[model samples]
Target: MKKTVCAIIIAAFSVCVWLQNAGAEDIKIGSILRLSQGASDGLPARRGVEIAVKEINAKGGIGGRKVEVIFEDSKDTDQAAVAAFQKLVSMDGVKVVIGPMKSSEVLAVAPIAMREKIVVITPNGTSPKISEAGEYVYRGCSRIDKQAEALTQFAKDPMKATGVAILYSNEPYGKGCNDLFTKQFTALGIPVVAVESFMVGDRDFSAQITKLKQSTFDLLFIPGYLQETAPAIAQARKMGIVAESMGVYGDMAPKYIELAGKAAEGHINASEYDEDYATGKNKKFKDAYYSIVKADANEPNNIMFAALTYDAMGLVAEAIAAKGNSPDGIRSYLDSVKDFDGVTGKLSFDANGDVVKQGVYIFKVQDGKYVKVK
Candidate 1:
């Protein structure tokens, strides 16, 4: 009887040890993204993180520990983003987080992330204000100012745009683009003849287009998410306001072309990733992304968001592997990182935690496809 009781106690101790070891084998990270509102961009961003995690785990993960990501829906609002960040940090105990993709959402959660000392990297936030958000906040994409500079230069030089008109979405991202691009255009000796704004879900752009038509402008620049931008461009073209249309990075998506149809022809925009970029790493990532997107017919196909988030996840993993899995450790690696090759480009971080990548690519829609013009 004594021997049996002793054996039972030893087995229970061993079981408890195994359970603890099993729990410790996984390194938990978190992601807050637009899973419901603005899902066209958000879904692809989520897939990018997932693909990177899968690849990392397949290669034995960071420091031989498996990686697990806890994802939360931001619902494309500031309040939802704050709640998501709180849940991820306080409840899930993740030291690193990879989203809240919009500039508004990123700014919303920046304070909490800084307070908690957690590493937060946004894959697509582009507001100039984000530069001052906090030391713990990082962005994987170029700022709107950078895009405006490159695009306005292209407009002045190649397009020969002497006068410009603006149609912008009345949101943080779109409004920021309008303000920056307007300044850039003015600096380049091109005058902005007219400016118009539309709400997020506004479909009938006839009124704005009519206002723009009254102005004698050689270039029409529309900056916003594709959901509104595409339809606005289609409506503008229908209203006969054809004067060399251009857009910011938000216009780079298959859905944009699909929505604009014939109106998308000759439309120009700045882009982060080039689908035809010749690299083994890019090819593998592109193939994996397409395979997954093709399997789900409902999935929105946009490689830009996915590519950015994939690189963000890759950088985070590299940081954890090089240093430890702490927020400070990750920030240290990012700050000193130079020429970290990503599918998007050779990436580094500036003093402001914004990605210093090879300059944005200029693409134009021709024959129902986006062809890199510069």
Candidate 2:
């Protein structure tokens, strides 16, 4: 009897040790983002991933292994993004990566991701070219052309603008939006009168605005990051050019309103997440996000980017949970997933790896807040 009791105790000890070892093993993931340049979007997105990871681990992580995310800054450049991807995959040994939010970065890293068979999900890379990036490359947001489709129609029916002028950022995303929206507006029978360009990090838009003022149009469309677009609109207003202002998804931030001041009023843009979206998931996410970021003055508050990444992290976790941690497993799970209830909306992946969400949202700034138009 003494020998039997000792054997049972040893067996229990071994089981406990095994369980501890299993729990100690972490499932690593990688995140590449614009942590330095354009951190307003990148920082919030990082917070979103943090929130999702925290929540996932809090509930006894996937298959008893804690999720560990290795974050790398893309520096808002294609070469940096490629280096980050290689480092994350080779050194960190992460099977899946979520980031390099810019379309250019995503495109830059696509070939490597495909060659290595790494699963990559970009939260905000909206250029239509990304649809053909690779089988392993996935996006979490709607394409820019889709936003143009919705915004251009809204401009035609409600805004009732006859002619439109564009001031586009010369970067890939901004230039892509300019081309797509110009086509969309023209398709809707709204002639694009004057087109101008501005470089990223450009604070002074007086030259562009001065030239834009030379053109007569009932509507002014500026497609670029709010850092430049907001100030451009402000300068345009200051320089005495008053036409209904429109922008792309980059303008959907509180900072835009703050920067543009009263100039932001009546400015319309596209959005992914709606705060008024009544869902327990959304409520929990918003509560958690504000609770964390509201106290940190250095943290930029843009829930849209955060929400997209939150959903991206959550979906990746779910994929890992269901299909295992391999790239093929995650890709299969993503391809098969339908109607994932996310903070943004019901999300699913199409054949092209583009997210099929509810659709784009049109929002106008009113009283210092974004009000949904359609």
Candidate 3:
């Protein structure tokens, strides 16, 4: 009876100690992301954050505090993103927030984040609208204009396209990309024949295809992530209303190609990060990425947005550690951040919370794989 009582007393003491330790220092970072539950682009976005958090925790953590991520699904909706951001800041009390795979979602979250004085970083929300979203908004990756500008610089030859059509998902992200693509193509002397918008969730492209079939656009600028774009392409290809010169990118995923099948072969997808961009840092990431995810994957596995998203979280942690983990100090440190050497390459943000780096490589699948064309 005495021994059993002693054991009970020790167990009770252990529980109390564990509870004390658990409450000591748990730093919560809000992850306002579309994730897998939101959109097809989210699969890799989540993977990137998971990978970085694991690596960061293994490296002694942020200032000896245990880091915790609070994931709130925004579902790629404006209202949902605004609500998620409120919940993260007002309820969960995350010191720093990262992500929302889509730009439209990022825009909704940014104003709230600015009001709360929290640091909100995007892996890749390149819509020019995000630059002035708020004081707290930061982008680890480059924006659409740069990517589009890069595409226009390198792929104008392919546009051998005398006339092209601009089809976009009637959303901010799609509209943003098409506006630039149309301007660039027109600058190259390619006339834009058809500029149409489709509802975000619409799957049937028959209506759009019928219109295109009757037109003479040699190319098309179909933008937006795969959920809508993929099915639209499949339907267009099925109708033999294919563009002589066509491509899509900015929201590249394996499913885009997989869902598009034979039609996806010659389709050029632009990317912000080229696996072969530079040396050491670039190569190491690629080798590790392929070994684990396998080389046969169909998606844009090496998406810089995802890698940069992971890096964005780590940047917040590092900044927090440097500034005593206080929100204000971290925000100040963030402003001072210049040319941060990240997994994607050198990251330098401008006054409006935009990165200075420019260029998005146009990639194509040669044999069921994405190969950098330039």
Candidate 4:
């Protein structure tokens, strides 16, 4: 009878311990990314978040709670993004989300995020409209206007181009860049000779290039994602259109050089993150990222997308650790924090939840590598 009593007491004590541990359960975070359709950019962005989460968990996690990320594929479409985001909010009960890499997708989910009072931070959606999306929406990348500013400056002093032509994607992001960069370039005294656009998945640029070739321009600015931009530039070069090629942040990837091949040489673009910044954290991140990428040959890796998303994940982890898992808690902490060191740069969110780093690095592709030009 005494032995039985002791056994019961031990069982009860074990249950109490288990209940306590369960109370301090893992903190869940949601991520909706373009895992399939736009995997080139999305895969690197996801890897950034994965690295941050892995490092955070290794260091005892957030506030003693193991951080868990629930990932959903956005499929790079508006309908898919909305569904993925709704699933995260409804089924996972996630208060914070990082994803929907495209501006259109982010815009599609913005209303729902605002209504649900969830925090949504996009690492690569650079539409200026996103600045006014909602209080619940934040962006880890510079707006299209900011990227245009850097590229325009480069156009004036370095390229010394008197006239430029634009070949942009027809989507929201591409259209925004075309408009903003044109304004910035014209403001800098560079006249826009021609403007042409192609659909998102357009593999043939023969028609677009024919029109662009007719325009007498010294510089060719293609401000779309690398997938289309690279091929377009390659076709333009093959057609003997020798206008110097330039682009925005999306063109900074090594894949751009690989896709454009010899045409990628002398290509100019702006980047938010400098891979050779010489910062200790950046060095560590690059080393870890290269190690991870080495293990998986199929996954695409790029500095701009990875660094931005890495900083986004770090920001989320900081906010969660400082405040809690609540949306308001994360926002409150994010608003007040400053000079948070990240692989991208010293990141601080402004009132609109836009990353406050004002500087953009000018990069040129030389010998199939991104060399910092300014």
For residues 91-126, could you state the per-residue lDDT of candidate 1 as single tens digits? 888999999888888998999988899999999888
Q: Name the runs in model 1 displaced over 4 angstroms.
A: 1-14, 17-19, 22-24
Candidate 2: which stretches are off by over 4 Å? 1-23
TM-score, predicted candidate 3 vs. hidden true structure: 0.83
Better model by lDDT: candidate 2 vs candidate 3: 2
Comparing 1 and 4 on lDDT, the stronger one: 1
lDDT, residue 191, candidate 1: 95
List, residue by residue over 30-106, the lDDT tens digit for candidate 2: 99988998899999999999999999999989998899999999998899999999999999899999998998899
Instruction: Note the Cα lDDT for every prediction shown.
Output: 0.92, 0.93, 0.72, 0.89
What does the lDDT come to for candidate 3? 0.72
User: Could you tell me how far off, in angstroms, the CA of residue 9 lies in candidate 2 after the best superposition?
Assistant: 25
Kindly report the root-mean-square deviation of model 2 from the true structure over all alpha carbons: 4.7
Worst 10 residues of 4 by lDDT: 299-308
The candidate, 1 or 4, that scores higher on TM-score is 1
Better of 3 and 4 by TM-score: 4
Model 4: per-residue Cα lDDT over 31-146, one tens digit each = 99888987888888888889899999999998888899998899978999999999999999999999878888999999999999999999988888889999999998888788
TM, every model? 0.95, 0.93, 0.83, 0.92
